[model samples]
Target: MAKAPVAGGYYPPVGFHFKVEFVGIGNDNDIRFQSVAGLTVEYDTESFKEGGENRFEHKLPLRTKYPDLSLKRGMLTDSKVIKWCLDALQNREFKPAQINVILLNEEHQPLKTWNVYNAWPKKWSVSDLNAQDNSIVIETLELSYNYFTVN
Candidate 1:
């Protein structure tokens, strides 16, 4: 395996970026989700430009300032990201939107999965999104909590 540069373990080689979209979240924890409206991408970057090392923080605004992650304290784990992504794609709990995840491997294979909250967008389409075989594309949504039960 090629040695992937570890930017908090999310692979920050200036190329591993994932373009994502929010479809909506599950019903139980849904809120008015504006975070998953447009196209957003998650990148493993140390700095906004380059050469700096600030770590990869989320670009989109979350509903909760802190997450209720049932863990003591460390760094924001990868599972948290996956959970956040899952929650933001539900319509009943979150605002309505259509979500489509496109995954790309090293060889550049487009693996697609569509998640719809209330409904899928007529205009939001999916196709082969190859990032030049340098990185992988993970489709996910950025969401906020109800602004009340956030820890």
Candidate 2:
């Protein structure tokens, strides 16, 4: 079995970044990513009306703007992960809807990875994380991720 060079442990430079192609279903294959950070997008919201009589009413056909995305994790609060992501997006090496995340630990080894999507924020930004791995501290200076996507 071939072992992944940067898996199961931490890697160096603490602050490492990379990019990967985002392959999705359908004809939207035009999407590509060069880095992982500061990428932005918009979300959609809606409302409805109910009841009647002489006053019962509500607002409809409404729209609002929000940050392209938001990321929150309980593993750590030092902001190192957040800062790294922000810098990657601002580097001008990547694009929206495509990013790669290279997770690392205290020793700077790769931990895990994921593909970012417009709806990914709602899923990853949970209040608390239930990482099943005990080899490293959940909220310690270990276990970091580098996000990016490819074309």
Candidate 3:
């Protein structure tokens, strides 16, 4: 028997620094975000029972669920993100946008990419102000997407 090759002195990529881009309708140009979170995909399983089956159970794939994506950054004067959210809230016919989350390597190059399809802003919020504490105003945008793909 032959043994499998083992990797030596290899380190995995860190997830600290990354960039996000919003593409498609409502956003003519690609918009970059400061930070991204809640990028996840999950699926439900459907189990079946057989009459003459052994102790083992059979399972099948079910519906897939994509969780909402949350983006946060320091408050900016730009109104693009806000406008998109407002349009969806006010306009009767709103268009979905494509979002891209790019993971970067230590050299600031893209290591992995995640594409979010048919995404629309679901919620928008801003951080509260404090009288004594000194902190930059932060804005958060939450989005709902049909599905996401990793590449």
**Better model by lDDT, 2 or 3?**
3
RMSD of 1: 17.3
Give one digit per residue, the lDDT tens place, for model 3 in 1-151.
6545658856677777777777643242324466788778777888898889989778888989988999887866756667777788777446788888889886788999999999888887889999997988888889888998999
Which candidate wins on lDDT? 3
**Model 3 lDDT on a 0 to 1 scale:** 0.78
Sort the candidates on TM-score, descending order.
3, 2, 1
CA lDDT of each prediction against the hidden true structure: 0.33, 0.36, 0.78
lDDT of 2 by residue, 103-150 (tens): 556544555555554322122232334477444223211112233342
TM-score of each: 0.20, 0.24, 0.80
How big is the positional error of residue 38 in model 1, measured in Å on the Cα after superposition?
18
Question: Pick by TM-score: which candidate is best?
Answer: 3
**37, model 3: CA deviation in Å?**
2.1
Model 1 residue 96 CA deviation in Å: 1.1
Better of 1 and 2 by TM-score: 2
